[model samples]
Target: MLDLNYILSSDYYKKELERIDRDNSVEQGLYFIIQSLLRSTIEEKYWVTDISTRSKKHIGFSKSVPDLTILEDGKTLFNPIAVAEIKYFPWSKKEYLTNNERQVKSYLKQVDKVIYTNGIEWIFLYGKGGSLERKESICLGNDRNTPESYYECINKKKLLSQIHWKNESDFKVSWDDLICKLGAFLK
Candidate 1:
């Protein structure tokens, strides 16, 4: 389990999101946030990352680089297991879903399993053709559990028609039993 309040309340953790990004990308902020969280919580899996495999495709050849990869424990298994794709906070749900589906489909060619996330929305993908789909959806900011982060993104239509906006925070995550969830996932 992780200390959500302790970790999230820190200036260091908060600073990661405050930094400026190249080309004004919203996704850049989350790269830092996810990196910070992984560093603080799951160092064993992600820290000292296997940089050699960061963007390198599998043996045969592939065109995409997964946002993150958890190598298959070759000691126990002969092939790699999980690869992940990430989205940004500013993107609409539709954008994240469609883009991640495409990304996971591409990654599936090289690995057996794929994970999709937006730092908060974690969806596990598996199976083939007809069976290819999302499963094990984990929302770090669950609607009832963590409403502060259950945002639907900004409504551009309403912004033009009326000056109204939803009051939601960006990329905020808390322990909220995620320690148990992550423990199950990591295993």
Candidate 2:
């Protein structure tokens, strides 16, 4: 399980969010938080990285580049444990969901676990569940606001609050539970 307090209390987590707030294009800040979560939950060595830069062969299908690739300790490129697609909150709601969903479905064709997220909201996807499958395992922010409105309301406090928020669905998974699910995906 991930240590939420350890991540939330870290100066790095706080500072990175501030930096992300200033420059939406700098995705590396997310890596720090994700690495912290992985470090706490999994025992084996793993890498949270952008494999697009690795080599021509590693670039995803149709020249698409996923935002992050989680490689297990002994896993090869053919079998990454998980991959993610991230968008900045200010992007249009339709593009954020529609385009990203297309991209995530493409990813799911190869990788079993795919995480689609804006900085505030996370949606987990897995292939091969058929009609009964719930592509989104859990969401953290659980807000109904549109992407633009959500971005407009962002601040350090709001960001932290959203990160700590429970899932909106009947299941109501907490941050700790979400992290544990993520940990399971990586394992």
Candidate 3:
């Protein structure tokens, strides 16, 4: 299982959150955070990278630059395993979620799997036979309006303790489950 306390409380994580709070390179900060998480958990054969430049050719995704892309064997865009769309804190706001979900669903046209997250809530979706299905929705914690609130949440261990599966109201989610699910998805 991944070490939630260490990962969440690390100096790097704290710095990234601070950068985000300052609104300095928000996308890059989010990318770094998510990249570290993916790199730490994913298999060796999988490469977690950012392909957010319009100049780069993502084949099927011409107009949109996916926040993060997973390539099998570090081969390139030709062998994409998954794509992640990241947002900032309070990304669960209805308007943001709705628009982001629509974008994620569009990615399903070419990629088999897509993840939409706000550094807290992870929505996993998979493409079927010309259709998209929401595989899971995992919430690491309840919404924190500000970055300081995040510090409080982690300090109090509320982030880990408040875990729950979005779809299954009664089901409690654990760090192991989060790591397992995300690792399995990437693999």
Candidate 4:
């Protein structure tokens, strides 16, 4: 189990959120959450500041800031211990679809797990082929219109653990739970 308080209250995360341009609210929120999770948990062994630069030679293009890039230990040179990418969103929509094959392939080539999210939802794309395997939602100000019990549903690990994104159904986790999980992971 991860700690859930420190992450939600971290000064670094708060500052980052404040610094982010409001125009990219969804990206800012998603970055804050993922950064909090990585900083609080995952004891990062090594990280690359500009992943786009590192990926340029292989992908033939560069990105402005990929949100976050992390690497874990590996048993063999050909395999990555853990790798992920997080994309924030204010809501769920097909318009945000990421079909950049070159970029996706670059990520898959470098890491074992690739994760993406909007502030409200999280999608995990795993394996070398980048399969969408799991997803979760966060209960936040935008979700205020939803019933309170919906948040409770996310807190129940049993319910969350059973969710699989492969079915193509949206996975919902409350913003409160997102904060809690991030807090736990951050600590």
Candidate 5:
């Protein structure tokens, strides 16, 4: 289980997320949060050796850059097993989700799995039939207006899973559940 008390109470976490909420670097800020969670060593099966935030290139013809990538064995330079992208969609969420999927597919063909999130929703994608398919999706927030971080969202309502396609559906996520979802993503 993850130590939610430490993360949610930290002033630094709130300040950093607020900064991300105001800027275009949503992916970087999300990466910072995830990296911090992994550094907490909450999981015994997997340990995040490296996580690149839009700096590492996906091994493909286009050499596209994903928003976030987690490397299991940090020995190789580009050994990325899982990739994630944090998108901010304040308008036309469906359109943004479609576009983000395209962005993930363009670069992350060889990666094992991918996570696409907007801090409020998390979409897990898997490559299938030469395309990226939505494996699962969950909404961890009810308020769509100001969902810039997990702290803001979870404090508001009940935490549920798999509320992505349902409109007006409110779901929440615990820190341990979030870590399990992202930690086992590579496998």
Candidate 6:
């Protein structure tokens, strides 16, 4: 579990978002956030980033680098617990969408939870009932009027716990809970 408050309230995250906006690249923004989450230490547990694996596709190739992969001992069976694909879109795009079911299933073949985001909207897909289920359209921010505004996935209770925006107050609550959940699943 990640400390939502710590991430949301951090000056580093804010400054990074501003930099991404100035560069007009939502992919960069998403990368920064994921890196921060991976760097975040919770109860002595730190997330590992970009744990690479060879895709089963036998193209006679060595290994390939995917965007991001997070591993934990719990529920991952010695594999990555989460894989994410981050995209970027301008404001002119009215709809943000993804094939979470397909994407998650493909990753789940090698990992657990699968998430896709385009800086504005995010879709999380995870295994349930022997199939993938989706939680969609989580809005990170409403400042879509600006072409350079930051958008992210709001912390949802199903994903973690109640998250306070832009405040350090109680960030540990969500982080602790998420670690526990991951531990239980791993066990």
What digit string (tens of lDDT, one per residue) describes model 1 on residues 1-187?
A: 8645314433343334333221223444455466445445442543312222443534322556666555433322124455556655444555665665655566676565666656545566765532465466655442211112423322111211111112233233334334444434544
lDDT at position 154, candidate 2: 51
My TM-score estimates for the predictions, one after another, are 0.53, 0.63, 0.69, 0.46, 0.59, 0.51
Off by over 4 Å in 2: 1-15, 23-25, 91-95, 129-132, 137-139, 142-173
Off by over 4 Å in 6: 1-11, 24-29, 41-43, 51-66, 73-78, 91-101, 119-122, 128-130, 142-187
Pairs that collide in candidate 2 are none
lDDT of 2 by residue, 45-127 (tens): 77666664565355545436676777877777666667777665444545665655656566766677777765456677777
lDDT against the true structure, per candidate, is 0.45, 0.56, 0.63, 0.42, 0.51, 0.45
lDDT of 6: 0.45
RMSD of 1: 8.8
Estimate the TM-score for candidate 6: 0.51
lDDT of 2: 0.56
**Model 4, 1-187: lDDT tens per residue?**
9755524443344334333323233344445455555555455454322243344444322332244655433433233344445543223355444454455555655554554554334444555544444444343322222223534433433311121122112222343355555433312
Q: Rank the candidates by TM-score, best first.
A: 3, 2, 5, 1, 6, 4
Candidate 4: which stretches are off by over 4 Å? 1-33, 44-50, 53-55, 58-67, 73-80, 86-92, 98-102, 130-187
The TM-score of candidate 2 is 0.63
Best candidate (score: lDDT): 3
How many pairs of residues collide in model 2? 0
Clashes of each: 0, 0, 0, 16, 2, 2
Clashing pairs in 6: 74-186, 75-186
Worst 10 residues of 1 by lDDT: 155-164
